[model samples]
Target: MSAHSPSELELERRAYRARQSRRSVLVAIASSIAFALVVWVTVINTSGWAGVQQAFFDPAIAWDALPRVWEGFLLNLQVLGLSVVTVAIVALLIALLRTLQGPVFLPLRALAAAYTDIFRGLPFIIVLYLVGFGLPTLADERIPVIYLGTIAVTLTYSAYVSEVIRAGIESVHPSQWLAARALGLGYGQTLRRIVLPQAFRRITPPLMNDFVAMQKDVGLISILGATDAVLAARIESAQTYNFTPYIVAGILFILLAIPTIRLTDWYTARLRRREQTGALL
Candidate 1:
């Protein structure tokens, strides 16, 4: 059998689509350059630009601060890694508790609901302070601040992540659970083997967004005297009376978050396209 080549009309359509794509790309690039140029002009024309640049954007100061900030950033990364694992475990348990469907489980469900509600409404910094300061006193032990910070982050984020997970679980079709049950699968088995896998797929983008947020917030551990990047930057800033070290820490955090942020966006768009078109890719 001979393969059929594209028809002339099909070829023309492909060529036109290619041209349109190229035009779109070129237009995007041009618009970006124009916007950047306008921003540069506006900022440089301001009377305080020179002082602001010296205070916040001094390259020499950034270089001077980099070693301490980098060392401290490693601690932030450690806390973030620990917090991610703890948050996932705690959030899943809470989500499961919230999803339980029985009068016998009413108390558990209510407790979980109250936990999420309170934590979600509370500011994370306040939680950090409470956990960082209060927990050590209660234990009557000299606990490390890094551990306290990680615990605080896990508690606050678990509330948010649990809601996202619960939403994903609820978004799963009820019929799937019924079908699993009909197949003689227990409730836990149905959730673990059938429902949760699908829910996780649906919720991955939001989970990643949360992870990116955690990366930035982990820097806040410095408030507890863990000497994480933010604290190191502050110490340097105080010594030099320049804010450049803070900018350096901020930039490092932005760099840390960029990959996860982009991944979340890409996954979101891919999920949207699959939902709209019924395409697996």
Candidate 2:
């Protein structure tokens, strides 16, 4: 019997073409709809656009709140950057602890699990309030609200990130561990040199997704009076009695979020390609 059949090859080619056509049509429709919506919004919000234009071009209004907005943006970036870095480090530690197996590891694992469960199960707003407002009152010390908010976010996000790291580590094949052991690597050495590296690559997509989520979660800090981008816009709107500032803030958020989203998609696609290549190999 021949390995290739003409009719089967033709069917496979036709199926591939059909799938490509469907994807192309979906993309076209989505693009068209998005474009149309943007046009419609621009047309309907002409007055708001005019306000924003005037505010930007008019030196008085532009200069008045611009500095405050920039300051708030810087503060937001600081909070976001600090929280993410702290969470990543702490999560890694917790994940490591959780993965260890022994009687002595039980208490440590229980503590890590409790931390994750408590934070992941609670509402972010409640956590923010507790950390920002409630803690200071209890401790009788005046902690900066911004610092409190940052800590709260860090704690909450670290729990979720720990789970990601734990899952990533577990996904590394047992054969890889055995191979590392055969190479005379100890448990810690095997994990650090082989298992962790592979797991890190495997979890990059999920980690990036968490980053995107954290970026938006930064907005929640505003509820704690952290004066982040959202709070800045709200304050500006309240003082000026105009909605343009809020609209501007929303646009800025979309600007920030869209790029992160694109990067996430790119990373996910790259990971999938790597997986496919590995499978083929």
Candidate 3:
């Protein structure tokens, strides 16, 4: 069969829309340029701009610090990598415990609830200090600072991620459980095959947000004398009294976070589109 040709009015409307799109793009670019120029002019004209630039934006200092900071950043990545795995395991178990239905499970549920409440209420830095210093004193063998830091991170984030996972699990419709059971699926099978997949899909954006937050927080391990990026920056800064290394570390973290941030945004929009279109999967 021959394809039907577009009508004259349809072609004209398409051309009009194209023109509008082009105009919008141009306007956006122009406005962005203007805003940037205003910011540059305002910033440079400030009284302390020169001192601030020398202290925080020195190219030479940044270049000098980059290698050490990058090395330390690898440690941060290691902590983050281990924490992600540990958090997933611990959080999933806690979430599952919280969701279990039985009179006998009351203690488990209460413990999970208390775990979340306590950790979530405690400041992360305090937890880091407690775990970092307190753990070392109790063990006869010397424990690595990195390990202690990772444990602290795991303890803190597991509580938060468990809540997120539990919320996702609860968000699944009750009928899904009944339908899976009606098809001869066991509770575990229903959760694995039917419920968790959907819950993960629904919760992915928030999960990614949590992951990004984790990426930044992993640098906190530096406080435990683990010599991560932040400590490296501090060392470099102390040498010359220039804060530029700190800026370099900040930029590196921002660069690390950018891809995940963009991915989260893209997936969130994709999910929104799917939901709007009533996609089943």
CA displacement after TM-score superposition, residue 171 of candidate 1 (Å): 1.1
Q: Tell me each candidate's TM-score.
A: 0.93, 0.78, 0.94
RMSD per prediction, one decimal?
A: 2.3, 6.0, 2.3
Please give, for residues 1-281, the per-residue lDDT of candidate 1 as tens digits.
99999999999999999999999999999999999999888997788999999999999999999999999999999999899899999999999999999899999999999999999999999999999999999999999877898899999999999999999999999999999999999999999999999999999998998898889889888888898899999999999999999999999999999989888999999888878895554
Clashes of each: 0, 0, 0
- Best model per TM-score: 3
Q: In candidate 1, which residue ranges exceed 4 Å CA deviation?
A: 1-8, 278-281
Over 1-281, each residue of candidate 3 has an lDDT whose tens digit, in order, gives 99999999999999999999999999999999999899888998788899999999999999999999999999999888899999999999999999999999999999999999999999999999999988988885679877998899999999999999999999999999999999999999999999999999999999899899999999898888989899999999999899999999999999999999999999999988977895554
For candidate 2, report its TM-score.
0.78
For model 2, the superposed segments whose C-alpha errors exceed 4 Å read: 1-67, 278-281
Clashing pairs in 1: none
